[model samples]
Target: MKQLNILLTAVALLLFTQEQAHSQIKLSDIFKKVTDRQSSSATSAGAPTTSEIGLGIKEALQLGVSAGADRLSVKDGFLGNLAVKILMPPEAQKVEKTLRGIGLNSLCDNVITSLNRAAEDAAKEAKPIFISAIKQMTLTDATNILLGKTDAATEYFKRVTSAQLTEKFSPIVTTSLNKVNATKYYSDLTTQYNRLPLVKPVNTNLTAYVTQKAIDGLFIEVAKEELKIRGNINARSSTLLQKVFGYADKKKS
Candidate 1:
């Protein structure tokens, strides 16, 4: 019995030593294991860092333009929509106000409506040129634009394509103005407005003004679409957009 008790005591002592060793594992050692695991995971994941912000910005800008352009190309997208109606600039505004102030409101209304209609007609011709611009947009260009301000992409577009678009749009607007009888309406309106006593003689090139206004309106619409995608969760139409923009959304949150 004494021998058996001694053997039992030895076995119990061995188990207690093992249990104590297991429980006595150093907190610092445990913490080191966790740190090593985290470091290995971080190295393996290889997520894009701060340097790639330019790239992300570019992707977002391109996506915005794509979405905006797509929306603008549709029927009633630019033409029938009053919200984005193409109108005159500061120069033409003076002419319009004078005309309306002189009780020639009907003539003034007609001329303004005709100008916008010409723009609407001319805008249809812009698809090919705008598409070419989009196609020519390089990864670097997109990255730079993405890194730019809210209107940076727009400014880039204006800098790069404005001359070409203006050149192309002028003839189209002129042709559309003629097609829609804009020249005659504006001529009559101008003659009536200029004859008003105490008013300066007003001479406006309807074609040039309409063309520029139309292009500006198109850009405005494009920007709206871009803003929607950047802000509204539901506006993200594709998986690529969702995946890429998901990061942007997280940052905002």
Candidate 2:
């Protein structure tokens, strides 16, 4: 089964060698495998190849990361996109309600805005981490991911990279939160809420909140980009992408 997968991948990869700019492949198609066997490459399997089949996986990751990062890490990246918008953390919901009920609507709004801005600021630092994680992919990882369900890569990243990303992002989120006065806004809101009659004091970690939110939003975009490649032919963006993903599509049908 593993040899067969490699043979099929290698044969499809030939389309990329004909000056057709086959380097641009989709991550979903690259990971469109359904086995949990040992990882094998086209060359090792003697199927014929210019590069390791894992290269295709890596390339797809690059595209997904670049697109995901580009779509985010910008003005209103998290704030404007409802799909991935950063909002008041669950623990702070009552604080928001209390603040809003107390007629501090502007304060509530500012705090939410600042949280999102911090997310955007911290998002800029994600590409290098994402790329590093991509480099860690093994042939087994590639094959398993390709054969797994859609968003499997996203789940893999979330599983493996989430902790590292949070560690890396926390300080950046802290800095960004401070830069955006999210800390001050949150502090002011919390301080005021705590003083209210019988209102519980809140001491949430603002940086941790934004870090996780940023990571979540980042993956949402990555999944979207992956789905685009999987389902939309126009979204494939390159001959290699078309050929590799077209194979997946044909097999599925």
Candidate 3:
């Protein structure tokens, strides 16, 4: 009977030990899982997702395009700003100089004014094209822009939209030039210059020249807007902009 009691006690002790070991394993597993979940959450909290980055980039571009278009579409936006003012083409510089020397300054002034006016009119139509390009940006493109140089976004826009902008701006510029009498004035100026003794015939494509200049001016404005958003915290108007650009700032630092 004593031997039977000893055997039973040993069995009970063994079972208790096994139960404690099993409980310890389960507790360890639970703790590990909890720790892992907390770590994952913390990591996610610090970094912006790919989707967030893309959205932020698009928003910034939209703001840039809108601001640029609005500013340039206004009166004297190109003419008043010497930085982007449309000047006579290189080949026609002598014509302007000769005309001015002959006291035809008023005619030269009119041509300059009309050229700027046509650019302003075309600038108003650029917002839609820029917005469309912004919408079409892929995740990879957005990621690259976010991490690229200060004017990387502007470069991307130039690459993607230049051809389309030219195609669209050609007709608009042509019509605007005709509407503003730029074509007529330039034709008259060139005709007069050609009639001059020993002067080469100078027939510049006013439409092409003005269209390219207008596009260049628009890009300059866009670059400024992009720089503002990338560098200035206040320019980040939305929460997403703040979050994504904040991440970018940290990464750059």
Candidate 4:
């Protein structure tokens, strides 16, 4: 009985010593592995440098801008898409209603069509403007966008380029309105409305109106594209895009 007790104590001590040494070795290895990962994670884990993120965002913006331009620059781009279709300004609503009530529905329709046509024409020039804004993006901008809301990039564009867009788009909208005889139709509507009893004259700047609406519609499309790229795994084209947006995807999951 004594021998049995002695044997058990020795075995227990041996196991305790072995376990303590094994745990020390394992803890050291684990810490070393963690340190190595921290050191290499910049180039590892599909390391996406800031510059790579910048380029990826730029590429995505370029594609988004080009796609938006192609879709909007065509006939019925705005007129056909009720989601983005431009309606008469607030001041023109009375004019439109009065004209339509007088059996001048065709006249009103022509004015509406011409307005949308002018917007579509002005939209052709938006691609370059959007590209310019994308090119102006810096590493900081890219990083923030990658970590921001789906529409964050689009909002950045409004902050940086709205003034420039307004300046460039106003003239084109004016030219396009004239080219499509939108002015003639608008004038006819307003002249008739002014002749109506108890109606105030509308001196709305159609050029500025269309220009602002066109810019708004352009941003809507851009936001949609940005959302699609951010949310859709298959939409990520480049490796950098995969890395940057993949991080987003993981967080979302």
Clashing pairs in 3: none
Q: lDDT per residue, candidate 2, 1-253, as tens digits?
A: 9999999999887866743554444444456552222255432443212234466656777899898988789999899999999889898998998788879999989999999998998888889988998898888787666556788788888888888888888988898898989999999988898988987788998887889899999999989877776778887676565555665565567
Ranking by TM-score: 3, 4, 2, 1
Q: lDDT: which is higher, 1 or 3?
A: 3
State each model's CA lDDT, in order. Answer: 0.69, 0.81, 0.94, 0.87
lDDT (Cα, tens digit) per residue for candidate 3, span 71-148: 999999999988899998899899999999999998888899999999999998899999999999999999999999
Estimate the TM-score of every prediction. Answer: 0.67, 0.77, 0.81, 0.80
Best by lDDT: 3
Give model 1's TM-score versus the native structure. 0.67
Off by over 4 Å in 3: 1-44
In model 1, residue pairs whose N, Cα or C atoms come closer than 3 Å (at least 3 residues apart or on different chains), thus clashing, are 57-146, 58-142
lDDT of 1 by residue, 1-253 (tens): 9999999999999999998887677766888899999999957745344445444544555566665555554554555677676555566678777767868787766766677777766666666666667667776666555444556667777777788879988998888788777888888877776786888777877777887887887788667766676678787666555644565555446
**Across residues 1-253, which tens digit of lDDT does each residue of candidate 4 receive?**
9999999999999999999999999999999999988989855775477778888889988998889877888999999988678888889988898888989998889888988998999889889888998888889998888888879899998899899889988988899999999999999889989998888899789999998988888888888889889888888888778887887666667
- Over 4 Å off in model 4, which ranges? 1-43, 251-253
C-alpha lDDT of candidate 3 relative to the true structure = 0.94
Best by TM-score: 3
Higher-scoring candidate on lDDT, 2 or 3: 3
